[model samples]
Target: MPDADRPQELPARLLTDPEMINACRLRDFARVFRLVKTKAGIYPSMIARRCELTPSRVGEVIAGRRHLLHMDVIERIADGLRIPGHMLGLARRSWETPQALVVTEREAQQPSEPEETPSSLPGPDVDSILAVATRTSLSPATLEAFRSSIEDYWRRDNQHGGEPLRPAIVGQLRHVVELLKEDRPPSIQHGLYGIAAELARLTGWTYFDARQYNQARAYFTEALHLAKEIDDRQFMANVLACMSLQATYQDKPADSLALVTAAQDQARSAIGTTPRVLSMLSMREAFAHATLGSQARTHEAIKEAHRQFERIGQDDPDPAWVSYFDEPKLIVDTGIAHGRLGEAATAEPLIADALRREDHSNQRGRAFHAFWLARTQLDQGKLDQACHTATQALQPASAVASERVSGHLKEFYDQLAPHRQEPVALAFEARLREALPLVSGSTRP
Candidate 1:
C-alpha cells in the first residue's frame, strides 16, 4: 500500500524532539483540541457534550495530563472529530511515546522508493492517440484506426483483457464527457456523446465477458439509449449488434437474429446518409444469420456487408464508431458464426486470421476470439490447441468483471468434460471447479 501520511510534497513544519515532547504534554492536548475545534467550527463544550464527557475532562485530555485511559474516551474523541479510528489510535500511541511521533515526522520527509524515470514509464502513445482522435473530424478511416488502437491495447496486456478495466475506462471516458459537457462547442459535445456511447458499449461487452448477463444488458440498453439520443444511427447499430451478441451468448439465437435484423433496418435507414453505419449493420446481420444456421441468408448478408464495406473508403466513412468494421473482424465474426453452426473447417482459417490480426488492447474481443477458436479446435479434435486457446482466453476473462465470458468458459469446460481422461482436459476441469466459487460470489444480486 502507498504511504498514507505522505502528501504530494513535504510540509515545512519541522518538529524538534523537545517540541515533540512538549506537544505530547497533557496541557498541550488542550491546544490540539482547540485547533481541531476551531477548524471544525465547533465549541469544545459542544464536543464534550456530544461525547457525554464534562468540559473539564475534555480539557484534561487536551492538557495531556489526563490519567484515565478509557478506550471509550479515545473512541469518543475520534468519533466526535470524525477522525479515523486507526489514526486516532496512532495519535494516542504517539502521545504515550513522543519519540514515535518524532520518528514518524522524520520518515514522512524521506523518499522511501526510487523515483521513476520518464524513460522507464510507458510512453505517451495513448496521449498521442487521443490527440489524433481529437484533432481530426469523424471519418471511417480514423474510426477504424481508433478501434485498432483500442484492440492493440488489449492484446498487449492479455492478462487484463476482459476485466473490469472496461468500467475504469468508462470512468475516464465519462470524465472526458463531463469536460465536454462544460462549455464545449456543439460539435465537440456530439463527438463526446458518440465516444460515451462507444465506451458504454465496451462496458457492456466487458460485463458480458465476465458472464454478468444482466449488467451487460443494462449497459447495452444505456448505450443504445444514448446512441438514439445522439441521433448517431451507426452507434445505435453497434449497440444493437452487442445486444445480438448478448442474446446469442444467452442461447437465444432467435432473439439474436431479431436484434441483427433491427440493426440491419437501422443501418439501411442510414445507408444513404451513413454508408459506414450500413456496413457495420450488414456485418452484424451476416453474423446473426450464420449463427441461426440460415446459410443462404448468411451468405447474402456477408455479400451485402462486403459491398457496403468496399464503399467505405478511408475518407468516406463516418468519424464515430465506423472504424470497427474491418475485414479481419468481419471475417472473424464470419468464422464464429460458422463455428456456431458446426462448420469448424469453414471457420478455422477466418478464426486464425482474426487471432493473428486481433488487437491486444481489446481484451474482451480477443477473449471472445480465443473462445471461438478454442471451440472450433475442440470440434476438430485438436484437444491440445483447444486447451491452450481456452487457457489464453481465461487469463483475460478472469481479469475482466464480465459474467457473459465466464458463462462461455463454463460452457467450454462443460464441453471438455467428455474428454476428462486427458490431462489437459482434467487440468481445465480443475480450474473451472476452482472458478465456480469466484463466479458464484461475484454475481450482482
Candidate 2:
C-alpha cells in the first residue's frame, strides 16, 4: 500500500489538547471528526476511506446525526483519526508511538516562541419595557423609562452584540413613534423626538452589526431625520458617526470621510459637547483617513483624538453610547487604523495593549479586537503566532452571537488559506471548524 494512502498522524500537541482529550473521553464523535477533518486536512471522504466506512456515515457522525457506540466502530475511528487509544478510554492501540519517542519528537517540533500572550477582557429584559411603552402618555416619567431602556439596550449591544435585540428594539421604536404624534408640551415633544432618534439609531446599530447595510442605512436616515426635527445637533452627529462607520465597512472611504466631517461640524456647533465626544469623532475620522490611504490625515486625526481624550472632564455630559469609546477603544481604533494602512508592526502592540485593558465582559468587542490583532500579526509574517492569537478570539466570539465578529473571523480564515498546510494553521483550522456552526449561524437583523 502507498504510504500516502495511510491515515496520517496528528501533531502531538493537538492530540494532547484538553479540549480534544475531553471530546474523545465523552465519545463525542461529531467533535472528534471535526477536529480530525480540520487539523489533518482530512476531508470526510478521506475519513471514510481510512476508516472503511461510507462517506455519508462519516458525515452523519460529524453532523451529530449518528453516534458510534459499538467498540469495533469506535476502534475504527481511533485508528482512522490516529488518536491515542488511552485518550478515548480504550486499551492502547498496537500502533501507538512509544512514549519516550513521542516526547522527544514533540520537543523537537515545539516552537520557542510561546502562544500569543493573553489579553484580558449586560442589559435588559424586554417585557417591562413594552408595558411602559404601551402607556399613551408623553409624561416625563414615561420619557425617562424609555431613556433608561435605551441605555440598557446600548449596554446590551456592547456586551452581547445587537443581533438578538433587534425585535424588541424595533417594537419599542414603533411605540415611541406613536407617542410622538400625540399633543404634548414643547419640552416633552422635543424629549420624545430625542428618544425616538435614540431608538432609531439603536435599531440601525443592530442592523449594522448584522451586516444588513440597507436596513441599517434606512434606520440611520430615520434617526437623522428625528434628530433634525428637534434640531439636536449632538444626536445628529452621533447618527452621522454611525453612518460613517458603515461607510468605512462598505469601503467607501471618501463617503466615510465626508460623513465624519459632517459629524465633526455638527459637534463643533452643538453646545455642551464633551471632549470625549470629539475624541470619538476624531477616531472615526482616523478610520476613514486610514481607509483612504491618507497617512498624514490619519495621523493627524488620531493625534487629535488623543488630545481630545486627554481633555475629558468629570462634568462633561457624554451621551451613554459614546461612553463606550474609552481608553481601550481609542487604542484599538488607532491600532486598527494602522493595520488598514499596512503598518502591522506599528499596530500590533497597541492592539495587544488594548486587549489587556479591555473589559472582559465586552465579549463582542474583544472578538473584534482579537481578530484585528491576529490580522496584524499575520501581516507581519508571524503565521504561527497569528493563529494562536486568533484561537484566543474564539472563546469570546462564541459567547455572543454577532455577525460582525463572525465576519472578522471569516476574513482572517480566508487570509490564512495560503498557509493552510502549516501545522499551527492546521490546528487553528480544526478549532475554527468546530466553531463554524456558531459563527455561521450568527443572528441577523
Residues 1-445, candidate 2: write the lDDT tens digits.
4898767888887888787888987878788778877876878998898887899999898888876643345667888778876676554554575645644442122222234544441112354476566765557888898899998988888788897787788778776776665788999999888998888899888878877676577578778878888888988899999999999989899999999999999999999889999999999999999999999999999999999999998888888778888899999999999999999999999999999999998888999999999999999999988999999998888877777888898889889988989999999988987777666344221
Query: lDDT value for candidate 1?
Result: 0.62
In terms of lDDT, the best-performing candidate is 2
Candidate 1 deviant stretches above 4 angstroms = 1-163, 166-196, 199-203, 271-276, 391-401, 427-445
RMSDs, each prediction? 17.8, 21.5
Question: Residues 1-445, candidate 1, lDDT per residue (tens digit)?
Answer: 2667321221123122344235323324465466555544556687677567898887787676663322334445554444432333222222233454545542122221224537755555765577656863444454455456555534432445445365455555455444443555676666556666666677666656555565566567657755776687666777888888778767787998899888777766764446666766776676677767888887787678678767776667475455665777878977876786788988888898888997666665676788888989999999988988887776556554445556567667777877979999877766656555544223221
Predictions in order: lDDT? 0.62, 0.83
lDDT for model 2, please: 0.83
TM-score per prediction, in order, is: 0.55, 0.69
Kindly give the number of clashing pairs for every candidate. 34, 1
